[model samples]
Target: MLDFAIFAVTFVIILVGAVLYLYPSSRRASGVPGLYPTDEKDGNLQDIVNKGSLHEFLVGLHQEFGSVASFWFGGRPVVSLGSVNHLQQHINPNHTTDSFETMLKSLLGYQSGMGGGANESVMRKKLYESAISNSLKNNFSTILQVVEELVGKWSSFPEAQHIPLCSHMLGLALKTVTQLGLGERFRDDAKVISFRKNHDAIWSEVGKGYMDGSLEKSSSRKAHYETALSEMESMLLSVAKERKAQRKQSVFVDALLQSSLTERQIMEDCMVFTLAGCVITANLCIWAVHFLSTSEEAQDNLYQELQDVLGSDPVSLDKIPHLRYCQQVLNETVRTAKLTPVAARLQEVEGKVDQHVIPKETLVIYALGVVLQDADTWSAPYRFDPARFEEDSARKSFCLLGFSGNQTCPELRFAYTVATVLVSTLVRRLKLHQLQGQVAEVRSELVSSPKEETWITVSRRS
Candidate 1:
């Protein structure tokens, strides 16, 4: 009994030692000069290590560390840059060091395979670009259809009943993106609905897993990850097979089919594309509605703009360009409520930004949430002022990282169109009301969204 007790004590000691060894340690010894010097008050390494909220913690760190601060996240050296010029230098398409597909693989749960190879990466970029160009040509009618359907359904819902705006937007986004990408509506079909539910569940679970690092350690997390991958592959395989049988060409699906990609690669690309569209589009729609509901003046101004431009006619693709205030409102929403609050990339090769030396293979995160809201860049950063985008004085301060220009998110054009249609259609027909005394709360995971089950009351505008 004494011998067993001794062994147990030794085992506990060893376990504690192992944990201490693994715990993230401060590594500020490098003393790398940053674009903005780190504030001594904000340099509490223990606070950073203890804070589990990635986005909030990062924002706080940036507040102290300046735009190009260096810090450690779980033994990984992360160089954070928030300056627009720095982002332009590093994240552009011509920048050979940035590996978008590799970053995407980490997010999408795909095994990083040969870094998508340089030639293949370029090809993928071209394919994405072509897909966007083609989607612009083909997706207008499909977007209008989705918007019309959403408006029709909301109008039919019993008046003054608080509608789950977030979920509804999510469902509508799923249907809209699927129709555009796969040429099929998956919202009502039982099999498709099940797939979407599973897909969303997987993302939610896996996002938790990634943030906590439980995905690597927990068996249940592994199972969830595998289940998500398997279910996604199964769904996509069925879709691909059907497309093959029908011999129909879809811009998204066909791009995958024709590529020399393995089955897993095709599945990863399809799932990421679909999921990205759904989350961003849905969140954008919800925020737009939320803003319009709270600001009667903004809504009235938008209604007038729509009336003059659309004038009881269905919002055509051609007229979208003329809806200037509508565009400004969406831009303001993006600025205030950034959908993708943070973006990360790894430095493949050593690079220098002024006096700061970023080593090769360093992880760099551009914290857009902080940067966009920074007082240095925006006046009245907290206010939801769409007019800021109207004046040249205010417009110069606006650096929306959504597309980020050179390394533009490929789907921005498509997402903008869908959001425009939805907003224009709804405001043209309905009077959106904020549930009395119910405030909308923002939720952040892999992407930022309104709290699930956000309720809004909608009535037809008389």
Candidate 2:
């Protein structure tokens, strides 16, 4: 008992000391009026690590501190930029390179090293982006085929059935990204299952290393983590080798194989997208379904738009542009759900926001949830209204954050195309409704999604 108590006290003292040591440099501006506010009341670290998820905590911080604030994350202080002007100042200039890679490494508790620099990654990045664009533009048959399979399975379910959307969407995203990223080799059921199992082992640890350090401290988890990574790397390398020897049909991996990047680099890139492409895309699809399920009017409007653009036919690439209302539903879903609630930039040099001076090497974050629901930018900010996007002005407000025209990532674009197809196909034939006596509470993991299984009953449209 005495030993355990001593350890606990030591841990708390170390934690407090670390927070004090790395507290923002502006802490010294005791009498200065220009520095951003801090949570000296010891609520700072708690807010960032709150179980309600970082998004909810950030919303509270922004509400209390206004446009700019600072909070402690362990020994590091993260500066939150909450306004449209503040967010634009960093993102608009695009000072950060490899933003996605930086986020991934930070979560994994790893550092960027040689051969992974900005310039070295440019060629591989272009190749991967071009492959996705070309595939979506010229070769969309794979996506259509996958959607057909998904619809057939859903139709086979009993009438007015309750479906667990998050699981199903994840499965759909896995099949879609795999077929696109790895090619037909993944179409093999066994191979897909093997890859998913290894992927899940790694994904289960996301955003955890930064807190518990389990990936490093726990021997069991460390071993499991290494095993999973090794299996995935071996799988990617084997496929890359086989494809290079045969010069088989073009795929994302094939494109990467021909690049000058090392095998390890290619493996890392695939791993990044494998985790990213699956979760975010799946969440977007599931959230849109949940929102539409609650609002019959939105469903009706979306169905009508679909019928006008693609009546009794599978969705095609050329038909995507004409489905304006469908696009609105998606845009509104991303905004309401706040799919990606935060983005960060590292300060290589000191910077200023308004009158405050930011110190060097600070991690500046864009609290996207706060901006997405800003009352000044979004009308009745919390209401889930698709009509808000009917005009070009709403999109111009910079409130859509990650889903906006200028802000989308490659995986987001791919997911949008997939999700638009899924929603269009299902909404035309069925009406989605939330299961009685049950509500889907948001679970803020690496991706924000339902805490419990998201159950939506689908009934055939009369």
Candidate 3:
């Protein structure tokens, strides 16, 4: 009740203030083609709400307005670049990881040390990126262990039993990310379950709440969301403290502990990785499994690649380069699912894209979904043909979008490694089959996921 009362009051205040501030006098800020506020106070926020998510809204927006478009975000003017040509003018993938970092922070309400000098922000980003990299490198065997355990469980299931693909993938991702990104405490199954409970509680509401302000309307939901956020933060606090006290630490933890960052900085970063890492890793695996299940040829090619490269041995770090077909399958899954549909960066200085001048501090969006499935770019763009990725042209398209190669953000790179290990193991042992009469439809939000409980049955290979 207290949570409700407080949020009710806060929501009312913001609502009233927004109405006055965004009164009918406000005008569209760009010459670029796009939407004006349907109601002056709400801008295109209502349109986004009506269309489901920003990604969906962009799909329609770009369709009507072409690749370069504008929309008001609340009262502020925002620009979206929806084509590869437009994005090439605006992106430095290396620097734009911060945009994703900011987006994650917004969705999770991770606002510790948010006010800092440029150098401090730079230092923290380097540390966070390094944390994921060092952890993956230093603890790869642990990743293998998690994959082996998951495969073992699947092997034990009765023949023809329908597996809850999303549910299991979420657990597998949670277990892998929590154990590797944090520590061995997650090796305890109970710890992983507890963490996942809180994670789901927060993620479920916040994914919509950040955009729609729905969480504040119900106090019960607010209370639960806040409670889970508190618990997750406390868990990270405990982990950080334990790392601090240890005289002997793994290279991963030691790098973080020795940093000049304040405790809150470390905690905020841990929150970013924990939440973003889990969702990305889980969804990537889910889509890859589902897509491969739907296409026997793709699965066969991936399985054959596994056999040829990793014949009679588990996937090794050195062997990843040789697993060309596996990489193609994953890349195609990313494009087909349009995983991570939208990303935005705040302009640091005034800039020009094509013919328009973007004012400093404007929110500039990368309309990744529009281009990922663009008909002009790919032949039969919606088709799930992994063979397309074999072409240097398709590969270049992926790189330009920052969805392939080293240009992808660190968390995605991390997810790719984890997915490769798990998928490689599963494909080697089981033939994944999609359930009959199930059409693929996605819920495109912060990331793309199956709109319903996606079920697949796997048969053990003789």
The best candidate in terms of TM-score = 3
lDDT of 2: 0.68
Tens digits of per-residue lDDT, candidate 1, 1-462, equal: 000000010111121122223232322315553333233433333453355345566677667777777664434456776765565455322232223333344545466343556776667656655765565567667777767877898899888687887878877777777776776645356755876876776656543443335667888868876887788778887777677677765557766677676766666677767766676777878888888887878888899999998787988878888999998888788777765566654455667666677766565566666667777777888888888887764554343353423444655556678888888888888888888888766654445677656787788889
Q: List candidate 1 segments past 4 Å from native.
A: 1-29, 33-52, 85-101, 107-116, 185-188, 210-213, 216-218, 259-263, 393-406
Q: Please tell me which model should have the higher lDDT, number 1 or number 2.
A: 2
Instruction: Encode model 3's per-residue lDDT on 322-362: one tens digit a residue.
Output: 99999998899999998877765555566778897776656
What is the C-alpha RMSD, rounded to one decimal, of candidate 2?
7.5
Query: Backbone clashes in each candidate structure, one number apiece?
Result: 0, 0, 0
lDDT, candidate 2, at 462: 86
Clashing pairs in 1: none
Off by over 4 Å in 3: 1-28, 91-97, 106-113, 210-212, 251-253
Ranking by TM-score: 3, 2, 1
Residue-level error in angstroms, candidate 1, position 138? 2.6
* Residue pairs clashing, model 3: none
